[model samples]
Target: MIKIALFNHKGGVGKTTLTVNIADALADLEKSVLIVDADPQCNITSFYMDESRLEELLGESGEDGSDATVWSALKPVVEGRGDVGSITPWEMRKGIHLLPGDVLMSDYEEELPTAWTECFARRQRGYSVTTALSRLVNNNAESLEVDVVLYDVGPNVGALNRVVILDCDLFITPVAADLFSLRALSTVGRSVAKWIADWQTIRSLASPADRESIFEGLPTYGGYITSAFKVHTGRSAANPHADWEKKIAPRVRDRVVSVLGAVNPDLIPNFGGNKVGGVKHFHSLAPEAQKYGFAIGKLRGYVNPGHYATVDDARSTFAALAREIVRRAGI
Candidate 1:
């Protein structure tokens, strides 16, 4: 399976939305997809399930000691009980499944920084802790036999995101046309470059057996996607956010693509440019889709003439984006 992470250091750039919609689009293309909600916020979990069902799944362990949430799977490692355990992902639709997120997953963050430092010493436990999520994901993906795994991570450059990013095969950043999002590219770029270098150093220090405990290498930089930009009409044919989009593109190239390319040119994909695809603002349609737990393309029994064009537009945009992602990842 191809493991791809939707990540960005800047928050509110539509990472969760992109992840769900893209997974939906991929499923429409007949690919079995598994979405790992690595974010402690559990936004995607809420999006996929109702409150009662979500509470039941994430509340506590069952009589058989089974808990389907991500935290429960990693609880053993976080609490020093043992390595990561298996999780039962919730099937959302025909071809889409979700490994639901947990607020308790934030507890795992405390162990990561210490584990990272110990990695240079080749400590077995250190490697185990750092690779917990990756191992959990790989095991589940294999069991589910999915074609792709999309990880939805939080917006940060902390130890948690570091380990998650290292575990991915490739990562795509979802950016908004704004200054904060633009500046966040630099932080994302520098942090990822350092993580790759540090991981390489750890690998070099490891024995063959130690190397077998973790992913072979860090994730490649899959291109960025512009998201949540408003599409203006009426008085002017041009989008008001066009200028910001223009600014974001070159900055992503300079800050992300170039910086990581310097570390290892192989880290960058040769096919897609720095800007992979974009999703325009969903406006009122966003809440409607979210309320019904559907992708914009899959909304049912809708007859709003006003939203007809927007729905059609969303369907095509996400479909094209999903295809581009599959092609770039060589899946």
Candidate 2:
């Protein structure tokens, strides 16, 4: 299975939205796929659920051990159980399933780093999140013939994000083109680059006794995607505006590649830019809220509720994004 993390450390960059919509597009292709919402906000899960289940899932409920919490699943990886494959997916469709996120996932930001620092940490124990996720999805892919695993990570680049990216074979980044986001694009890219570098450096430093126990197989970063490039309202869509087609395209394309260029050739994630039509949807509070899973229906009552594609002139941009991912991943 081709595993990829749709991540950016900056919020408001359409990470979860891209995760849900693109995975849905892959479902349209009859590809068996699973989306693991690692974000604590759980926005991706809320979109699939109505308001009622959101309340229950987000609440501090019982620890009867029957219930599935994202936090509890991390335990098998944290201890020396070497068990990362037991968690089952919550089915959403014939081709698509989800491992829902809980608010407790936010705490992982602090826990993963500390766990990795411990001397007793095992290969699977040090990075429970990835090992478990990899094991679960890898097993499912082989047994059930699934095609992909996509992770929707929270807006942090600590050990959890590091582990997730490490395990992934591809990365489709969702980013906004604002000044802050552009800066974030560079910073996050550098962080990911350094993360891979850290793995090799640590591997070399490990004593013969500690090497196998501490470092699991090293992770690789595949290509990335930049989503939701804003369009100026007054710009002419009547024809290919020379400015947008020529001048704007190259700069935007370069922005993504520039950051990822200087890393381990095979290990550095490739950044291929893509667009989500977020600007047109931003005007209506209902559309904005629905995108974030704060509402049940479309921004315009006339728009079909289940039709959640990132529609631009009625074209599903997300489907194109999914196709691009499948092609680039060579799946």
Candidate 3:
């Protein structure tokens, strides 16, 4: 299965939105998709599920009967109970499943950092901690039979992302048209490079059996989705904020080329060449879709009257973006 992470080191870049809609779009095309919400904020999980259910599954008292969150599977390894347990994915739709995220996932961040260092010391627990997510996915792959696994990570270059990104086969960054995002492109490139190099350094010292489960080659930069842009032309494309696109797109390409080109030059050939799709400001449609608890692609007519145009734009843009990402990632 192809694993893709919807990531950006900067928040408010529509990473969660892209993750949800892309899963919907891919599922519409009959691809079995699994969205693993790795973000501790659990925004994707909150989007799919109601607050009451979240409280029940991951409450303050932690008294839930079901353990469906990704953290549940990892708790076994983290607490030295056992290996990673089988994951129970909640089916969001016919062909789409969610390995929901939990707020408590933040608690494991410290343990993961400790494990990262201890792994090189030949501690079995350290290696297990590093490979927990991969093991969880592999444990469920046969039953899930998923075609694609999508990851949603919070905006940080923390230990959590260090583990998740290692398991990813390709990464699709959701970027906003802003100066901050332009600067963030460089940070993301550098962070990913360091993570890969450090992991490889550790892997070089691992035993044959440990190496089998310790590392999956780092994911390559697949492409980018430009989101949250002000559409001055409003789909007319006469003069749609040319300066924002002109500034950010080329810089994004350069950052990726400079960071990853030495290893995977073919992933991004030139400026704007790796841009998969552009999503303009999806303002009202975003809340509307969230209110309905479904993807905008699945929104229907007459229910949300007078917003048919907005729904159409949301559906078409996300569908096209998903298609382009899948094609570019060669899934």
lDDT of 3 at 326: 70
Candidate 1's C-alpha runs over 4 A off are 61-64, 229-240
In candidate 3, which residue ranges exceed 4 Å CA deviation?
Answer: 60-66, 229-240, 263-272
Per-model CA lDDT versus the true structure = 0.86, 0.58, 0.78
Who is ahead in TM-score, 2 or 3? Answer: 3
Rate residue 286 of model 3 by lDDT: 77
Give lDDT tens digits, candidate 1, residues 1-331: 9999988999988898899899999999999999998888999999989999988887673323466788888888877778787788889998999999988778888889899889998988889889999999999899999999999989999988898888888999988877788789999999999999999999999999888777876689888999874332335436647777888878888999899999999898687477789898988877778888879877646638777888889899999999999888888
Using alpha carbons, what is the TM-score of model 3?
0.91
Model 3 / residue 214 / CA error / Å:
2.5
Measured against the true structure, the TM-scores of the candidates, in listed sequence, are 0.94, 0.73, 0.91
- Give lDDT for model 3: 0.78
- Model 2 per-residue lDDT tens digits across residues 1-331: 7777876777776677667666767887777887777777777787777778767655632232324555555544544444642444678767887777777765555666665554233443453443454555565556656788888887777766776776677665554544455556665667777776666565566667655543343344444445443433244455432233333334434544444455555544443434322322333443454555422122335455544443342235556666777777777
How do these models rank on lDDT, best leading? 1, 3, 2
Give the C-alpha miss distance for residue 228 in model 2, angstroms.
3.7
Looking at model 3, residue 126 earns an lDDT score of 85
